[model samples]
Target chain A: MTSPARQLRGKDERAPVALSDRAMDNLRFIRETMERSASFTHVSGIGGVAMGLVAVAAAWAASRTTSDGAWLSIWLGAAGASFALSAFLMGRKSRAEGVALLSGPGRRFAWSMTPALAAGGVLTAALARGGHFGLLPGTWLLLYGASIVTGGSHSVRPVPVMGMAFMLAGVAALASPPAWGDAYMAAAFGGLHVVFGLLIWRKHGG
Target chain B: MAASSGAVRRRSLEPAERAPGNLDAVHGRTQESGPLELDQLIHERVRLGIVSALAVNGSLTFTDLRDLLGTTDGNLSAHARRLEDAGYVACKKSFDGRTPRTEYGLTEVGKRALNAYLDHMEAIIDATRE
Candidate 1:
């Protein structure tokens, strides 16, 4: 009911500021800074599950192919699709959290993962060029695991663990016969993704 | 002229003696209320920002702290120096390749002080609600 000018004069007559307002301002400042400094841990669980499903399908389709070229084509298609899906879902999650998809911790996460993924890409091309088709699964799993471990360092707990699981599967694939390659891909990419995806969803709110 | 000069000296000394401009002032301000004392050192805007950031991030480079707080080099250094002098923060000087890096972190004393400060603020909010 007080006039604006009267309220201003009344406030001036009192202490320079109210303690409650000052405290509230300080708390808000602290919260915003903490949020800014936090790592981007919103790697999507649903996205991971979806990627797993796609990988499973790719493995099935690949197993039925007559030529090595056809097998590679199926997997490459799945990788592309999975990457797109994960990126889209991650972007959505970032938006929901009111965080930028490409700034701060998100940028750090991407930077950490880049080298391993780049290595994977180059190795994939070189191995394929050499007609080293049997080595593809182990190489893919190992390098992809390396990428996850590095990137997931900036994400949640299960992410790096998932990467380690992939690395273990890669070691197994490398030690086992080439005939077991598809199975290792299925277990590592499909199974690992689904299991850890569920964990991340439950723990991190999907 | 001697009396006038003496008066000026006394006047300057009065403010310094009365204010003291540190923990004593903080104590005097809070003496009015029994439970409303705040750590004036950390109550400052920029210093509070520095402490809060370090509390969350564990450690931050000087550049990171400055950029995060949107403060200048001189301002940040001054405030950070105050915190370090109080034993509330620690500073490490290192080199990244050829570039010099200064990292700052909240010490144990600082963490406890921040916790106390937070508790005091929450108490104020709660008391006001009543």
Candidate 2:
């Protein structure tokens, strides 16, 4: 069967086309260029919210712990949950969008994000070893912020802004007293995640 | 079967339907016109979208193109076949475990044609604006 596209072409040929064919071509070219240059948009707002909730719970759990080791374990558990949730949600979004998980923009996002997370891990270990656990909150927030900012450079726009907000919270955490670490972590990771995650969902879609 | 073969023969004879490497005739026409003429094969909206998407994305599955263009399977398949016949696109058919998967990518000539088409459009816009 002649396709609908072919039928449409036949009709156009029999009539005086309203838009000159050349003009149509120009429009299509502009649109396609823009589409091609856009970043991968599979990041999930719901995933961010989920991570935020986990962070908040981790903060609450850490507060109840008597030892720094137990506190670290709770936060570490939150980190693992966040990673898994983010990956699962991102994969779902990619599939829904018909984009591969390892597409060009996705690869760029991953490449830009890995180093910051690695640094965060190294710093966490070293700080814990040296018993300078109070610095952990600031370092975590700063590095996480740096990761988001760097990755967001390759992702949608709001991500970098969120990253900057996390960085500012990190700076505040650093300057505050050691006793305030849990509260600052809660604000940065928990509050910021929920707020910005909602913003991303509203602006960029789920 | 006879009708299908006849359609193929007609497609083969059309000047605009020339294969990619044999684009000298089309280019010669463009040189005569002062600006390149757009490839009618790539000019239609659905076809244009398919080529444009493939030009940017290294490769896309049949489902990917269908979803991107919001077209029916029959529609996408027909258009894709036309592009493939023109030597403008390369198609790879494979099995992903239990299901068949078809992927499409722009051929080198296809890329050249798209670039030329864009340049022609730009030139027309420039001429009209002036």
Q: List TM-scores of chain B, every candidate.
A: 0.73, 0.74
The candidate 2 chain B region of ten consecutive residues with least summed lDDT is B1-10
Q: In model 2, what are the clashing residue pairs, if there are any?
A: none
DockQ of 1: 0.23
True contacts kept of 2: 0.09
Give the TM-score of each candidate. 0.58, 0.57
> What is the Cα-based lDDT of residue A151 in candidate 2?
88
Candidate 1 lDDT over B6-125, as tens digits, reads 211122112322411222122123435443435877878899899998997768899988988999999999999999999999999999999999999999999999998887666544
TM-score: model 2, chain A: 0.82
Model 2: per-residue Cα lDDT over B23-123, one tens digit each: 22221133355434447787677788888888766778898888878899999999999999999999999999989999999999999988877764554
Please state the error at residue A135 of candidate 1 in Å: 0.4
